[model samples]
Target: MRRRKLHNLQEEFINKFLETIENNEEYLEFINRHKPELLSNCDIAIREVKFFDVFNNTQLNNLIKGISNLNKEKYSIDLSLMSKKYKDLNYLIIQYDNSSTRSLCEVTFKDDLFINNVRAGFTQINNNQAVVEFSISFKEIMTHNLWIDFIKENKELLYGKKFFGYYNIGEMIKSAHFALIYNSISKVIDAALQAKLLSVFSLNFGNEYTLPQYNAIHVPQEHFKKEYFDNMFLCRTYEINNKYLIVDITSDEGLKMDLYFSGLYSSINFLQLLARYRMDLYYFLFEKIERFEINRRVNKYFLNSRKRIALKDYRWLINKIRSLNDNKLRENYTDSRELLEDWKSFYDGKEEEFIDFENGQYTKKYNTIYSECFDHIKMAYSIQKENLVIYIATLSLIASLIGIVTTVLLG
Candidate 1:
């Protein structure tokens, strides 16, 4: 069989992913609804950062201090350093990386628009995970038509494209404004990576062309028809595999755009959802790592032992498989056990969108990896148990033979 290239594998994965989503009856029905001509009057951008690990003690402290000083001196931004501890759905403190110490910064993008807050944080337990969150919002009150033009003009930025040419919002203004904010955020991240404060790994599909992000749009209540669900093209942009959650807010009583986007409770809920999604990505990556590790160990075991593999060596493999299962079953920062329940309460009976969002992201894929890992663990445990019984029976036979020899010699 000919070996396939990495790019080919990525292309295949992407194709299969799109096929699965596009073929879903619900998704198809939702997409087939009458496409809305209405556009958003305001837009919000949420970017998710997944850091594999963070530095320890001195190194971490220095990086935080350096970034804080740089933010004040160069970006004219104040930094707030705080510790946050989150409890799971049952109000129990999660055992894995439950607390995070983060530094927050706020920047004003323009007179009315703001890049509300940017956070860079690391977990307290082993510093195994970190999250960076930031959002951009346009505060100008514009007519729906003007907002449509605004989205059209700034599509490049909204879509998270790195570069583009000639937008109606004045090429210079578009470039300068976004570039300044992006660069400011990028500088902090770059510094962290350079200082070894955080580390990240690339997925098999390769580096994403654009940042992982979600968009929130405020549309008029009359325009928030079922057809708007099919507007995924504009919300997702050209990144098929990088589809993000698009939340459309209307002017209904509790669903008011202003309150949904700006209310304290709503903001916190949005942050929780974002955090959960980030953690989901983390689990997906961790599972891939574990799967690769298991395969590598299995291959190494066969190659190194050939035909003389010891029982102890087998025991090591069994222990490793058990460890993998233990890690998978351990409680994490996000409590997925009650994810649906929490999302239902938060969305106020609109949990379908959340479900779709998770499915679109990596929830289904994560479950697939999890099931694969579980199978491996199960097989390893079965083998271990069988070997243990055989070893015990062999020892019993040897003892009986020794006892019979002693009796024969005495006779």
Candidate 2:
């Protein structure tokens, strides 16, 4: 969470990765010959943490109270006394008392960072319907080379691990519940999720001297003047728009300030929250996939209804974004306008890709349902027609018999 240590580690990793690649003769020759300016911009990778257990409003309230009154054990959940039906105890929200630490994440919730603002609870996610979420965030400034295995490596870190819930391993208690199952998750182990890392490769590398190398990105000079800030020496801002500003510092100290100001301290926070849209997309596909594999007799009506509901939901969401983008909600981010634009392009492109994928998936499923239903209808119609033909023949034969009998009697 401390800036200096993270900065040094990233610097070391980048240099190590690049230097190690010297063993690759072809790559070395190409870089030497070409003298290519290899600069990778910083990237922020947002990750999500979720639990499958569902918590009703009452349970959510109970958890909130327990977190609020951390000094008391009265609200502490007793595993033995609770119902067997109760699975894992999950937190919809955890509001640590006035002692909770504050950081960039607090800014996302519009809370002050220096003081522990108990009002701003750490949120792993913005969704109030969550089963449990402990949102803790900090930043990483990585070079492109480091990304080769940086994320995977980061996952193994116990950097900021903390126990947020209750547990007693003594007295044959394996967890918060069911000793045999021992699967009760009152603790979110290895809690830090590597939500995002910002890579710092410059788009314009050669012009490092004339102007700030990181200052290659341009915006209209009128909006974001460097002098507009309270302490110009601490950081610089390049205008992205009326609402958005870009960080324009060339040094680590400068980047730190840029990270704070342009990042709005909570930029990653906002992003992590927005990232939930992805969860919906994944869940929708997951449900359909499960249905296909597990349910042998998927009904036509259910398929049709699902198809319509998904289409409508996506359409509404897309339209909502369009409306927002029309006027455009403005926010700023670090090190050049290019980095900010990259985030926008990344989000927009992914949104479109996901929507397109869902449309294709649901469309295919609906067609399968319709085809099966149509075949059944056709078979039923054929059977009814055959019965009608047999009935007509029987009536004609009876009439013929009656006519013959009448003729004989008359003669």
Candidate 3:
């Protein structure tokens, strides 16, 4: 049985390689020149290894040997280049591998033949299928006003015929953004086109967009209607003057399109801008949680709830706690010793006996619920911070009045 499994795995790998080479001319040429025998061996092996126990030790050894000899050097996934095609526009991309460890990099460049460069680390986790990261600083792009001027100055170059060259900026941006939410990206594109809000702009382009193919642009508000049940924001699109465009996006509660628009590039740098906006919010909340030393308790709360607390439940908890701030009930704590003992009983090498497939499905359902609950909590935090600031300012003003009164009485 094990022999068959290994052979089947090898067959799948071979099929993938064949398909890749057949579809990609560059790869096909590389394979033909370096390893013709490897391809033939794969085809023959598939015919011989059909049954569960067919492959003996020698056959398995030969299969491994043939694969190792293939010209795999040409298929390396790495970010090999970052160069500006336009005078003002700079491009950044890395060849990515989703099958392995996460890859992160820092991008830096400047105008006027490479001046002082800045560096920031970018780490991309798998959103689903595409390996994507949002560490690039879109704030580096000039404001919307300057971008307009740049577009006017080089409309023909950015949107003209010359922009269709290799490594096109338009395609890259689309690829990058689509990587973030590829499953829903097509819906966003369709909605944007229906709204008729497609346009390209750049402050540093010499008609680069015109030279390359442009992917359909999308804005979230153009499509998604605010649903009462969706406690988190999904990708959406909006229409302006009969043209479909992306207007707003919601990820978590603290993240909104308005917050992103407030940053430097409200429109031109869409993907990177959204990423920067999310990072700011994520880090902001992370710092607050760490500073308050609430990670352990919050995490425990999530686990106990089976990660399925509803949005309404989240609001209720926050409001109830807010009302009970000074009450002894707020300070009352449950001793965890008994709970720990119970957990330990399950931990003693008997987890497999108790946990069935149904538990996995149940966990997923609850996880969504728990995520929505956290979104509401984040919104509550934002409100709490605003109130805190107002309270401090009011207290300061009152103290100043008391000091002024005391001085006058003494005089």
Candidate 4:
């Protein structure tokens, strides 16, 4: 794409990384050795792979411990973990001492597949839900035709069709395929669950594709060329659907550094965005009382003390929704912010309509939910106060009668 650069910081960072690669003797030698194959055959270079999955936080502490143990046992290395903090004022309301931190573990593989480095992590979204992310870096070179074939095959695999093939890794005698890569991921998830780290209610796998800078100027297909690259910022071609995200950068900018960073950031952020949306929907539905059932439900909420317990849960839900909504699009960079907002709008179902569907409904529903909770809690308190008054009055009468009887007996 040939659009204006979104931000200078991104450009500078990408350029610096490219410069480092150029200056490194090992990288330069590898480039020179593969120059012929790279120039003549490779149309699209698959630089990285990222996968995200959501899980329920059944045993959050155990899950973290399990992840740490898994890394130590499997990779023989400690987890490279860090907490992602939001300094935005909006986040201050939601921040708590025990808030879940993002924990990460890096695993490197040799002679297995095109993938070399894999970093996996999890971020707890709410008290009950969490998301695990996998970022894989690849050094695979593929012809333009092979690239197209891979995309097609991958799409089928994503949609639940089984297919397998092997790709030669440079001059190595052994070859690796996508099946092995996917199998490894499945094993990790299975192990986590089997070991009772975390119980999962549902699981979804999402993918992000980062093409090398060389393909930015020369997109493989004419349609994609017209759709993505024509008069758009190289980074602006952040195409996302329910299935996958395609992130690219301009050739002149540098190597695929921007791709690596942005892809990871966007994939993780988008998953969070989607998770929050689903949570909002789920909470709304869980608490929603239909008009026909409103009277019965209200009575149940008021008279039945057990049903009133949901009021506390409702309060928690309100706080969670507010935190998630307020914390959207907190990124400082323009491209990242824009991409997240775009993805939010897409998942929020605001793309086609004139009205903001998700946010508008959110505001209205939130107000209704807040008001309902307030009224129910207030009524419950009032009933308790009335009962206390009656109890005190009855006790006073009993005491007076006892005093009168004692005085009569004394007289």
Best by lDDT: 4
| C-alpha RMSD for every candidate | 15.4, 20.8, 27.7, 18.2
Tens-place lDDT per residue, model 4, 36-70, is 54442234334444444444433333433444444
**Local distance difference test, each candidate:** 0.35, 0.29, 0.28, 0.37
Q: Which segments of model 3 are wrong by more than 4 Å?
A: 1-103, 112-128, 134-141, 153-157, 160-411
Consecutive 10-residue window with the lowest summed lDDT within model 2 = 197-206
lDDT-best of 2 and 4: 4
lDDT of 3 at 383: 69
Worst 10 residues of 4 by lDDT: 207-216
| TM per prediction | 0.36, 0.25, 0.19, 0.36
RMSD of 1: 15.4
**2 or 3, greater by TM-score:** 2
lDDT of 3 by residue, 58-145 (tens): 3223322332332334221123223232222112222222112222222332331211221112222112111122222223233323
Model 1 scores a TM of: 0.36
| lDDT per residue as tens, model 2, 1-411 | 464555455445333333433344544554455442221111222222221111234444444443433323322221211222344444333321111212211212122121111112222212233222223232332223333344334432322222111123222222222322122210112121111110100111101111111111222233333344324343333223332233323331112112212322223332222222222222222333323322333343234433222233334233323322321111111122332342311121122222222223533453354455445434544655677789898899999999999999998
Per-structure clash totals for the candidates = 0, 20, 31, 1
Per-residue lDDT tens digits for candidate 1, residues 1-411, read 112443344334333323433354443343344223212322332222222332334344444455444433324444455322231111112333234344444443232222222344333322222434433333443333343343333322222211111122233233434333222222222222222211112111112212222333334455444333434332221111112234323211111012222212123233344344444433332434444444544454334443334455455455443423333433342354354444321233232334433432444454454455456545555776888899999999999999999999999
**Pairing residues by index, what is the TM-score of model 2?**
0.25
Of the candidates numbered 3 and 4, which has the greater TM-score value? 4
Model 4 vs. true fold: TM: 0.36
Q: Give the RMSD in angstroms, all C-alphas superposed, for model 2.
A: 20.8
